[model samples]
Target chain A: MKFTIQVNEGPYQHQATDSAYLFTKAALEKGHEIFRVFFYHDGVNNGTRLTTPPQDDRNIVKRWSELSAEHDLDLVICVAAAQRRGIVDDGEAERNGKDATNIAPGFRISGLGQLVEGAIQSDRLVVFGD
Target chain B: MSEIKKFMYVNRRAPYGTIYAWESLEVVLIGAAFEQDVSMAFIDDGVYQLTKGQDTTGLEMKNFSPTYSALGDYEVTKIYIEKESLEERGLTLEDLQHLTWEDEDEDWAEKDSIKLVSRAEMAQVFADQDVFFNF
Candidate 1:
């Protein structure tokens, strides 16, 4: 079965964004196809390339990048949400004339329509949040 | 046979805590606009949405609980709540102003479409949905 998971909260706040990392890993471990991972609201922060967690803690950004790289999953950050939170990729930053972009590779900035499209295309859209 | 596409919108925060509640409502509206059957589940702080008599007063935000009623107009009438959350917060059915009690329906109480259920059941519902989103 194909699954499209939406992560909309946590990590930045008191909740856990690790849900995004764990769910994606579990889906792949189970041999299920990950249709996409749509990050909306504060959840878009998960795609930022500039996140630096404590050395003892889990590196969520790196985990997401590795999962996307190895499994070839579509890791999408809602562009509107990302822009609102200042999480721009190099292309978006350049278009907006910013000095630098913070979004990581393997993750693309997309519109909320991509989230809607994920719903339309995937068999299951499991949401992970607080 | 093709499986019916089921969409579940997870409202995780309070109605006024942030823009999450409003954005979540929009996403659900979009899902219904696509002719998909959509359901909503309130968890953690999200239960505040169903609480009665919210006075935003000086918060300078919109009171969107009424929009919950409008969801039915969009063909999204199934709203679920977690039982443990209700008890943990000391909220009962009466604490919610908009919800109709299951027992109130003489014939449908046993099968009332909208009401509260246990967390385990909520987990099952999550597993059942084709499109599950959090706000």
Candidate 2:
């Protein structure tokens, strides 16, 4: 089964990203093909490299970044949403004349068309949103 | 690829006080360029999105309700509003904006785009869709 996961909320503020991450991980473990994971709205916060949790807490952003690295996943943050939420990439920082880029590893900024394309290409498009 | 798939945008939030409605419309507009069989389903608080005569002067937010009118121009002709949702919100079809589309096949005749459907019917509509994006 091919799947496209859409996370529509922030990492810790909402449970959407955690659920999406766990679902994607479980699906991958089950030998399912994850075509793409498109993050939208506040979900773009998950791709920020500056996320820091306490020493005892789970690192949500790092976990997603590592998961994508292990699975070779296509982790996409909607460019429009990311720009609004301050999730900047190197290219975006350069183009927008910003000083820094905070996008985590294994994630790229893109358009909403990627969400639509993921839906069309995958067998199922699961949305984990609040 | 010439393949066409059924796509549905499920709206269940009130228009203002949040960014969901606006962002969801952005996705719909972008998704329209895909030339898929697209449909917009308004249920629960989402029914308020189509209500006519919405004013946002003091709110300072850009009123995007009018953009729903232009959807027809983008070939998004299927606008489904759940019947029970309207009733629960104390709104009738008359309270909603009239949406219509021009059918070029019929010599450019104007046609109604709004389809008031029952909850059961809306579920059937959902079941028929290849993909659903909920907001």
Candidate 3:
């Protein structure tokens, strides 16, 4: 089965990001295809590279980056949502006249259409949020 | 080609207080272009989204309440409002805006777009969905 995961909350504010990550990993371990992981709302915070947790704590952003790299998964952050919350990639930062980009590794900023596309293409669209 | 699927957007939040309600509408508007089988469930505080006489002037917000009426123009006609949600909030179907859509298949007849469903009926609607989006 193919699954598309949507995480709608930020890393630490809610347990949604953690649950989504674990679910994605478990699905991959079960040999299922992860079509995409689309981040919207506060979930776009997960794509920022500037987060620094305690040395002993799990780094949610780093975990997602590593998982995406290992599985070659598509981690999409909604461009509209990202812009509202200042989660910019290099291209977006340059275009928006910002001085820096903070998008985490293995994540790309895209439109909301990607979420709809994920729904159409995947066997299941699991949403984790408030 | 991607296969069409039954997509249900579960809305449980009130508008303006948070960005979830407005952002969810954005997804639904974009999702409409995909031509999927789409439906929206308004439960909990989400039922407040359909209430009439909304004025955001004092709040300095954009007043997105009118957008709900425009949903029909985008072919997003199946809006389900939970019966219990309405009653719990001291509201009824009459407290909501009279939303309607023209059914071309029915000879361009204007039809009510919102459906009032019991909680039990909503459970069955959930069971029928291939995808569930909650925000």
Candidate 4:
């Protein structure tokens, strides 16, 4: 089955991101296809490259990037929500006149239509949110 | 051609103090362009999001309550408010802004969009949906 996962909270402070990651991992391990992982609201914060957790921690954002690299996951952050929360990619930073971009690798900024499309394209649209 | 899927935006948060309500609205508005069969369900504290006299003046927020009225313009005519949720919160149909849509097929006759459903009815609505964007 193809799955599109939505994460609605940021990393660390909320368990939604962790749960989404684990679920995606388990699904991929079971040989199910992950259509996309669309991040919204505070979930956009998970795409900021500046997130630095303690060395002993799980490194949630890095984990997502590595997983995406391994399995070619479509990591999408809502542009409107991301802009409101200061999660900027290089193109967005340049367009918005920001000093720098901090978006983590393997994640892309997109419109909310991406989520809608994911719903239409995927077999299951699973949400892990607060 | 692709089949039109049933999409429901589940609103369960209060209008303010949290960003979920507004963000969910944004998604709905954007999703409207996809031409999918979309509907909205306001339950729990989410019913407060549609109050008629919403005053964000003191809070200094954008006061997006008015935007709900324009949902009909996007052809999103279904707004389901749980009957039990309203009764539990001591609210009635009169407390909310009357949302309506002009049906072009019906010669532009304005029709009510808000549908009051019992909890069981709401459960059936959920089961009918192919995708749910829950807040």
- Indicate which candidate wins on DockQ: 3
Top candidate by lDDT: 4
Candidate number of the best TM-score: 4
lDDT of 2 by residue, A1-130 (tens): 9999999998879988889999999999999999999999899999999988998988999999899999999999999999898999989999899999999999999999999999988899999986
Model 4 lDDT, residue A67, Cα: 97
Per model, state how many residue pairs clash: 2, 0, 0, 0
**Candidate 2 lDDT, B9-106, residue by residue in tens:** 99999999788999999999999888999999999999999999999999998989999999999999999999999999789999999999999999
* DockQ (model 2, Cα): 0.76
TM-score of candidate 3 relative to the true fold: 0.96
Query: After aligning candidate 1 to the native by TM-score, how far in Å is the CA of B105 from where it should be?
Result: 24
* Rank by TM-score (best first): 4, 2, 3, 1
**Better by TM-score, candidate 4 or 1:** 4
Q: For candidate 4, write residues B18-83 as lDDT tens digits.
A: 999999999999998899999999999999999999999999998999999999999999999999
Stretches off by above 4 angstroms in model 4 are none
Q: What are the runs in model 2 whose C-alpha is more than 4 Å off?
A: none
Interface RMSD of each: 3.6, 0.9, 1.0, 1.3
Writing each residue's lDDT as its tens digit, candidate 4 over A3-122 gives: 999999989989999999999999999999999999999999989889889999989999999999999999999999999989998889999999989999899999999999999999
User: Which CAPRI tier for candidate 2?
Assistant: medium
lDDT of 3 by residue, B6-76 (tens): 88988999988999999999999988999888899999999998889999999998889889998889888
Off by over 4 Å in 1: A10-15, A54-57, A90-100, B1-4, B10-13, B18-20, B41-47, B50-57, B65-73, B77-135
